[model samples]
Target: MKSNVYMFLLGTMCLLLLSCGEEKLPKPRAMLRLNYPAPVYEDLDMDCSYTVKKNKMVQIKNAKYTRPCWYNMYYPDLKATVYLSHYEIKNNLDSLLRDAQNLTMEHHIKADGIKNKEHINEEEKVYGTLYIVSGNAASPYQFYVTDSIKHFVSGSVYFDARPNYDSILPAANYLQNDLMHFMETIQWKN
Candidate 1:
C-alpha cells in the first residue's frame, strides 16, 4: 500500500538524520561560571567609636548620618551593600540585643535556617553573635558585635538584585569574609 511505503521512507529518513547527528537535542541545565579574585584588605580608620580593617574592593559610604558610627560598605561591582548600625549601650543593653535578635529573626519567613555563632575576645572585651541566614531573603547575613558594656554594632548585607540565592551567593560570600574581617579588627575606643 502507499501508506506502508510512506511509513518506510519516513523511518529511513529519521534513521539517516539521527545517524548523521544532525538532530540537536536540548542540553541539560548548567550553572554559570563566575570567578572572582581573592580580596586585598586595607585598614579603614574612622573618627567613630570603633575602627575596622575593610576589604579594598569595598568602599565606604556615609549613607546613615542620622546615627553616630553608622555607615555602609558599598560593593559597586557586586551591586550590594553591607549596612552598619552602631549603638551606644546607654542603659539599654538588653533592649539592643533583643532588637538585634528580632531583626535577624524577621528573615526566618524566607530563610531556610538561621545559624548563630558567638565570638569573644576577652582581652579586648569584644563579644558578639554572628548570624548566617541561609535562604533567598533580603539579607543573607546579619551580625551584632558588642563589648557588652558600651559598644554595640550590627550589620546586614543586602543585594540590590531580586531574592535569588543562586545569583547572589557569590557576592554574599565575598562580603561575608569582609564582614568577619571588619568584626575581628573592631577596636572599641570606649
Candidate 2:
C-alpha cells in the first residue's frame, strides 16, 4: 500500500512537471502592414499646355470625357487615379476658383473635416490650395494651381475601392505626397 501511494504521488508530480514546461500565452493581435516603394518622378511628357513632374509609378492617360488637357494619372498597383484638368484662364478666374472650391465642398457631407494648405511660388507665378479631406469621402484629396491670369490646373484623387477612410488612408497619404511634389514641380508654358 505504501509503495503504491508513493508511485501514484511520483507519477502525479511527473505529470504536473511535464505539463508545466512552458506557460501558454495568447498571441498579440496581428496588424496590417503596407509598404510602398519610394517615388521616382520624371517630367510628364505630353502635348498638354502645362508641364509638371509625375511619379514614374503612374501612367498618364486621357480622361474619359477627353476634354482639352484633361488627364488621368493612374496608379495600377494602388488602384487610384489622379484626375487633372487644365484650363486657359480667360477672364474666368473667379468662376474657376469657385468651381474648384465647390467640388471640394461637395465632399463635406461625407467628410469628417477638410483642411486646406495654400501654396504660393511667386517666381513661378504658381498659387493654389491643396484640400485634404478626411473621412469616407469619395475624393480624399483635391487642389487647384493657377497663375491667376493665363493658366489654371485642378486635380483630385479617387480610389477604385469603396470609400473606406481607414483602409485607404495609407494609399491616400502616399498619393497626397506625390501630388504635393507634382504641384511643386509644375511649370506653365509661357
Model 1 segments more than 4 A misplaced: 1-25
Give every collision pair in model 1.
Answer: none
For model 1, residues 37-155, the per-residue Cα lDDT tens digits are 78887877887888778888787898657776788989888889989988888999999999999999999999999998787889888888889888887898889999988889998
| TM-score for each candidate, following the candidate numbering | 0.85, 0.85
Model 2, residue pairs in steric clash: none
- Global lDDT scores for all candidate models: 0.85, 0.92
Location of the lowest summed lDDT over 10 successive residues in candidate 2: 45-54
Residue-by-residue lDDT tens digits, candidate 2, 1-190: 9999999999999999899877899999886777899999888957876788888899887899868899999999799999999999899999999999999999999999999988999999999899999999999999999999999999999999999999998898899899889779898888
Q: How far is candidate 2 from the true structure (C-alpha RMSD, Å)?
A: 3.0
Q: Which stretches of candidate 2 lie over 4 Å from their true place?
A: 1-29
